[model samples]
Target chain A: MRVSLSEFRPPREGAAAPALRELRDEELIERVQQGQRRAFDEIVRRYKGRLNNFILRMVHDPLEAEELTQDTLIRVYVHADKYREIARFSTWVFTIATNLVRNRVRQRKRQPTWLSLNPAPEDDEVPLDPPDPRADPSRQVEREELGRLISHATSRIPEKYRVPFLLREVEQLSYEEIQRVTGLKLGTVRSRINRARARFRRHIKPLLRNEALLAELEQIEARLAAEEGSDSDD
Target chain B: MFCRRARSFISLALDGALPADRTITLTRHLEGCARCREYQTDLQLGRRLLATSAPALADGFEWRLQLRLNRTLQEAARAAASAWDAPPAGAGRWLRGAGLAAVGGLALAAAVGLFLLPGEWSVPAPREPGVPGALVERNAPQEPAPASAPQIAIVEAPATVTSTAGDPTRTSVSGQSRTTWFGREGTGRAVDLRLSGAPDPRGLLERQGWSGGSLEDLRSIATLRDQNRRLRDALAQAQREVILLRAQSDTARGGLAADAGGQREAPQTR
Candidate 1:
């Protein structure tokens, strides 16, 4: 059966058995060196999604993330000889992605073309429009307030700190690994993560006092619990 | 305690980099201090939320990447195959041909000199009678004989002349006729002499007139000279071949010695 790329989405929870069943990254790399097309395909199958998401978080553009991910894979193929077994394949792959992201950011700074594409302000800004009269007032108020808080908090954090923060808090990479990917010192990586959390907290504090943030949090927890139930059934 | 260093330590503790003992101490301190506790809790909560929200791999990204990688591998394989199949460059082919030609020319010259030259000398038929007879006739006086001279005169006169001289080897005929006979014999002898003459036979050939005898002598000299030159050239080529072969052999031997030494040293290293 042909397994499509879409079918390879990461399981939300860890699957120890599948991880064991898959070939080790180094073994896949060796196969690639020997001109095994399938091996390279397997490698791409293993890393592409994770890498794409990682790049997406950094660039915040799905198209650009996809392009950068493809570029990273191409680099891996071209410079396969340069890979050393000493470093984990994930580290090496992320290093390539990070470099590309950094270059894109630098290029944007110089050219400023990306400024126009800044994820439409409307997409980021919480709608100030009043709730529909027919809608339940409590539900509408909660949704509006939560949306406003998340947008304000996420948008206020500078891109530099936001990435490290997201990566640490959201992506869960260890400080050393983050250091490897970002070419930052361990100290700097931690500081960025800390600063990102502080910024997030400052933005959310005002909205959190309104009680809607707490209600939204409860709703998220309920959704997660439902997801857990379905996962358990599987 | 909440200094810059302490703040940095707090960040490190949040990242799970603090040693176990230090982490415990930091945790205890954070629990008691409201401000620090709030900071630590916020950081942890933010990190957890972000981790949960970080995007999962997009649909079909892995498959597309796989396809690209496969194409790349195939292209590299084809390139390698083509390179392996292509003919070697012109300089390599030319060098190989030149080396063969040089070795062949040397071997040919060596065979000709070693086998043919001595064989020519060992031949008895052409060397004895023709050479002696030609020498004797050349020494005799030159004289023109009548075209109608009888066959008996030639035979009987030599017998009579030998009897008169009292030595069968010594015989005299008419001066003019004898001169003509001697001239022909001398030319014939010269032809034979030129074949195995001195190192430089050209000097001897130059004295002879351009007649059939002289032409024969010149041709024999030319042939011998050519043979000598070929022999010398072949010897030189053989010498060069020997030197090259020796160097190659020595190199091979050296390599073998090195390999043997390496084998001998392996056990010691282990």
Candidate 2:
């Protein structure tokens, strides 16, 4: 009598982890639906970066993002029965993440109005210096700082446009996927993403000192417009 | 629409979200408006910067989430199991305990009634159907069951002891319940019960050093035969007198003293 209880438990992450990692995303979800906790474990491990990035940009705090990301996975576990297979699993899962991030934003908005009492987080911490004097790391350090600036700028985008924008730009979700995750109309997805880009450009334009990149962008757009001629989707 | 509406479309155009029909309108406006063209270049730069600089997640995120999930599920299962196993609080707990005990006691009693009753004692059995119920009841003794010791009858039969087998008490091979008896010496020639088919009694008297003899033989050997005979006859005579006196007393309840006086006078005259 081989009892099923022990086998049903998702295998611990030691010997069986590599095999679980090899399973496809939907296959993992199917396993999870059949009560395999390790499958969900793999799903959480796979999507942490993508979900954490969107959540961190939305909530503007790393700790809350981590917390919300955990909350999203838990909701996925609790509501595993309701997942429909016809839909893309990522769309359904990111929708859960998006909804949690939305709720967290609403909760933060409900806090006390004494903004001065809640002092803004300090941002004056210095970046760690390169250790070796001969390490020639100036370019890497500069690029890191630029990346930090870009993250800060993206975080500042308005709440309405922020989620759809991150879904489109950072997560690379299709427009329809952005609509599904954020539960917005197609037009809303388009307009919010556009607005998000315009605001992001306005914020980051003064930080960079690159004339050639801007000139190249203009040449490319002009050439594209010229090539299209009279052909139009309309 | 002039650069005002076209400005919004510059972003959509950069993202290729603009309808093909609206592209011409945005394009003509952008061709005339250098300011909008500059805005478009800035938008593209910002898009490139965001796409390139999207931050990586913190390390060990999945490991932490897995631990938390396992802990939560274990807690939920424990809570559910306890709720199922636990009886209600207060009076219901006491009531349930009492009810379970009562049910167990009843079941045990029922099992005893069903299987433990004596089968041979109840109702008339097939072997004793001719025996009257009253006679059966009258003969039934209110005494403890007798021990398994073999009873020796002190009768005057001639000694018929069987050959001394290895063990007379061994009844299994013989297929009979009786044990072998010992014969008295000098009581005439002994007849072996093996030929006579008389069963041995395996008497305790035989096991002791006492002679296996009838009461008459024992009395004669002790030289008290006449005395023993006389005592037995005297006891029987006394019992007969007692019975006659009881009959006379019943007839002459008030005439007992008068009859005694008349009998004395008659004896004097004679």
Best by lDDT: 2
Q: Name the docking class for model 1.
A: incorrect
Interface C-alpha root-mean-square deviation of candidate 1:
24.4
> Against the native chain B, what TM-score does each candidate's chain B reach?
0.29, 0.31
Interface RMSD of each: 24.4, 26.2
Which 10-residue span in candidate 1 chain A carries the lowest summed lDDT?
A: A1-10
Task: Write candidate 2's Cα lDDT for A90-207 as tens digits.
Answer: 8988999988888878887998643357754344422233354433355445435655777788877888888888888878788898887877899888889878887887787775
Tens digits of per-residue lDDT for model 2 on B134-200? 1111112232332332221111112221332432221111332111222221111111111112122
Candidate 1 Cα deviation (angstroms), residue A52 = 2.8
TM-scores for all predictions: 0.46, 0.49
Question: For every model in order, what is the number of clashing pairs?
Answer: 18, 1
lDDT of 2 at B105: 34
Q: Write the per-residue lDDT of candidate 1 for residues A135-185, one digit (tens) a residue.
A: 465654554454444544676789888766655654566777778877788
- Evaluate chain B of model 1: give its TM-score: 0.29
- Each model's DockQ? 0.10, 0.13
